[model samples]
Target: MAANTDETTDAELVAEIARQVPDASADEAAAIAVAIGAHLTDRQRAAAAAAAAAGSEETWDGKEWSFSGRIDATQKRHVRVRQESPTDPWSAAGRTDRM
Candidate 1:
């Protein structure tokens, strides 16, 4: 006869992973998520890496800046771009390809 059994779900797996990396920050958690996602498919890994690299921003002269901010429930804007203009003339050409 077949016996009833319990199985671990993807959420359970992720939670187990998170439990293992207790010291991980929010960013680290996201990286771990991508890595786990990558193991499932090669295309997903490449896409995750590309997305990670593309989101990295640096100053005009190649200097990187660290920033942090948040919006409360009163103002729930998904994205905010703070550039000099719609067409940022100061940005180096060819950098657009990175995205």
Candidate 2:
């Protein structure tokens, strides 16, 4: 689901989550929303980390190419990442370094 986290307040998240689980108590709904939100936040962080792992950047250079991702070292974690403009001539020519 596309979301603007900056505009998604905690209470709003709780309310939305409660709406999804109508049977849950207010406290239960809030808790579920908090947990779910945290997971989603972590997922985003992991993906961002993967894109920035090589350095403090979200791209390969001052060009159209770009990369971003994250790696979750936690017990339940897995790989998450993204690379843009893979069809660029430089990429097609095969560069040795990986972002």
- Maximum-lDDT candidate: 2
What is candidate 2's lDDT per residue for 47-91, written digit by digit as tens? 989878856544535433222222132223342233453535456
Q: 1-99, model 1: which lDDT tens digit per residue?
A: 112123223565566667889988655665666565556556676899999888774433322211112222223433332343123433422233232
Worst 10 residues of 2 by lDDT: 65-74
User: How many pairs of residues collide in each model?
Assistant: 0, 7
Error of 1 at 47 (Å): 18
Against the reference, the lDDT scores of all candidates come to 0.46, 0.55
**TM-scores vs. true structure, each candidate:** 0.27, 0.42
- Which residue pairs collide in model 2, if any? 46-70, 47-69, 47-70, 50-69, 50-70, 51-68, 51-69
Cα lDDT over the full model 2: 0.55
Off by over 4 Å in 1: 1-14, 43-99
